[model samples]
Target: MPVIRPRRLRQTPAFRAIARQTRVHPNELILPAFVREGIGAPVEISSMPGVVQHTLDSLRRAAVDAADAGVGGIMLFGVPAVRDAMGTGATDPDGILNVATAAVVAEVGDALVVQTDLCLDEFTDHGHCGVLDARGHVDNDATLERYADMAIAQAEAGSRLVGMSGMMDGQVAVAREALDAAGHQGIAILAYSAKYASAFYGPFREAVDSQLQGDRRTYQLDPANGREGLREAALDLAEGADVVMVKPAMPYLDVLAGVAASSPVPVWAYQVSGEYAMLEAAARNGWIDRDAAIAEAVLGIRRAGADAVLTYHATELALALRG
Candidate 1:
């Protein structure tokens, strides 16, 4: 009797919709955008088909679009025109990221959360997430000081959330302390708690024009270690992370699920550059249905217990969801 029964719900779209256990809402999706300094027009990332490094004007327009489409937030990553050993741009009040943050906040102030990427990779000449020591290794404690300064600058720029993606120890605590000291007690920290040193970041390197000569295995978690991800989340949580994220989420769904299960704060997953590129490449080659694959990918992350998702497809998907 059961052999014939399963097909009943599968037979109609309406029935399937009603039976669906997981859904991605526009309000649960955050768009990560890149705004490059010195660009008069938006430039497309060759590795990531639909994603672009925006000009100031385009960034404002994009923020407006994201807000109008009901996206919950937009995370801004700045591509500076120059890079320095100390990543001075990251802490500058008029830095590209800060300016973009101010522009976005002004464009859509209360409509959506404007977030900033509080990492040094895009500003550092070496393309490392932190300052390097005399020995050429990333200096952890020294980097935290930079992050603390960067957080206040972002808060001053009107960012509601500062995303700490540098994978440095005690970053959340340092940033929180600095922000509170500067009278920005309301700004929140979103820690990239379980980010792995994944090959999946290749496309992102291109998107940011990375100058990294070596891998970030020293700071980023190893892809093979699931338990370490949980440990990182716990550490970040204790350090005052308002939200914790798992990066390159598709390959780390198990880690994401584990964190989501135990985390007291909101848990987010990033469908990063490579994930976006893979789907776009496949769709371009007629190997997959773009919309269906995107919907499924995001739904899987949501089903894995992500409270929110950072995706390159956020705006388009949000518009589609509305229809």
Candidate 2:
């Protein structure tokens, strides 16, 4: 007998297909969208090539397109026309995010889930995710109140799921309580449980026109710690997170796998701005096969145990998969 012919399965397409353990589906992908307050035309994010900060009208069209493509959801981030110390726009019923959320929900209806980025960084003048204390540090308890308010605002704006990406301690519990009290009991929470302070967010600054003055090392997880990611997930789950997410998915696959293995709730990952930029840059330089690389990256994320993935490439990937 031949000695353990492992190549037998690898030798044919049918065998390879049967052996494949992971796959990317349109229904498991969510598109991340940026909608700006005062733009007559959609503004392309230079760092993120094909991606753009959409006007309200354009954002509506994009959401409909994503829904028609069979994407699972669209997570909206708003760029307001002004900023303040308290990030008031985050909780304002009339805020740009709220308006955009309403528009998307109305446009797509039940075709796809509409989610909102429940972070204040985009609205704060100082660019921190929360309000600052007299000493200049983020006031954790005070910030929790703001988060609770923002959650209710997003929920009222028609966001089915509010992504708590601020990484604030006790935020999930507080937001959950606020939503329940406001009689928005059906709203869900998608906690950014394992978001890390990575350099990968560089391009996102331009996308949101972020005003961040300093690093978020105090609140965001350190990139070096994998075990901490699980702890954060556990805490968020205990506080009633409907789903837990690991951000900048490619660099944190180990963390993603660990969270997926232990998490009782669904595990999702964000293929952040930097990851998308690298692939685009290489493709533009004729250095890599973009489509194949995109497929491989998303498949690898799914294999690492992500139940869903939020990516800039969601619509394109969905269209390609359908073909």
Candidate 3:
């Protein structure tokens, strides 16, 4: 005699299927792609078994497949052959990420949204998000200038949405003003509003070939705090973020939900490489069913009110969900 009668939907598979309000679709998935400089084949990351660091050719092929699967978008990151103190490569029109973005846009055209990472870590030898000051700390204002330049570069290279993942103060305003002043007002900004400093990014370091001298504790959100996440999102919204994101989606579902509930624009969540690898490793160990786990994780994010999810297993999950 339960007041809610929750068992009504559990009567049968057909009933559960028919009554389901939450669903996973290919158009809700966004694949994270990596393009390295002058590589011939895909290089697998040890921490993430099935994921790879893609060469241009491989990246193009994978993008084609994802587009064919009807994914919502592709998020691009670069691994440059050279790095410097200010991450100068990031702002170069001919840089690895910019060139790759152009290439992917040519390959996919209007089929999917092509997003570019507007950050410095992949281009800096020191692996910080910006130029180091006299004391070797990341200079926020200098970094903002660099981000503005990178925003222009990304827009010029055919990126539809620029992913601002550095968690820098005033990044959105800086980049927005830069892009607008350059007459690239069509370009959108997807801010990593609540990116936390967590152990979850360990695999991404390997994926990006990072040479970071220190942690991102100063810029990224503290994992111990949840209210700070909302504050960051608030700042990003006030600064013209077209979309706001919460990184490492699983551990931050509440944050995602809170942000989505309050956000005026779309909310996205990233299933970081470490999250992908952990689930994959557990599946490989015969501890959990891979497909089920992937679907469940994705569904959980959807339930958390994410408009879209950036995931390493985006293609596979899309295929499975479609079937």
Which lDDT tens digits does candidate 3 get at residues 27-118? 99999988898788889989998888998888899999999888999999999999998898998888899999999999999798999998
> What are the TM-scores, per candidate, against the unseen true structure?
0.98, 0.98, 0.98
> What's the C-alpha lDDT at position 2 in model 3?
71
Error of 3 at 196 (Å): 0.1
For each candidate, the alpha-carbon lDDT, in order, equals 0.94, 0.95, 0.93
How do the candidates rank by TM-score, highest first? 2, 3, 1
Error of 2 at 166 (Å): 0.4
Clashes of 1: 0
Q: Name model 1 segments beyond 4 Å from true.
A: 1-4
Tens-digit lDDT track of model 2 for 13-115? 9999898778788999999999999889999999999999999999999998998899999999999999999999988889999999999999999798999
Judging by lDDT against the true structure, name the best candidate. Answer: 2
Give the residue spans of candidate 2 off by over 4 A: none
Which is the winner by lDDT between candidate 1 and candidate 2?
A: 2
| TM-score-superior candidate, 2 or 3 | 2
User: Can you write out model 1's per-residue Cα lDDT over 48-133, one digit (the tens) per residue?
Assistant: 99899999999999988998999999999999999999999988888899988998888898899999999999999999999999
**Model 1 score (lDDT):** 0.94
How big is the positional error of residue 108 in model 3, measured in Å on the Cα after superposition? Answer: 0.4
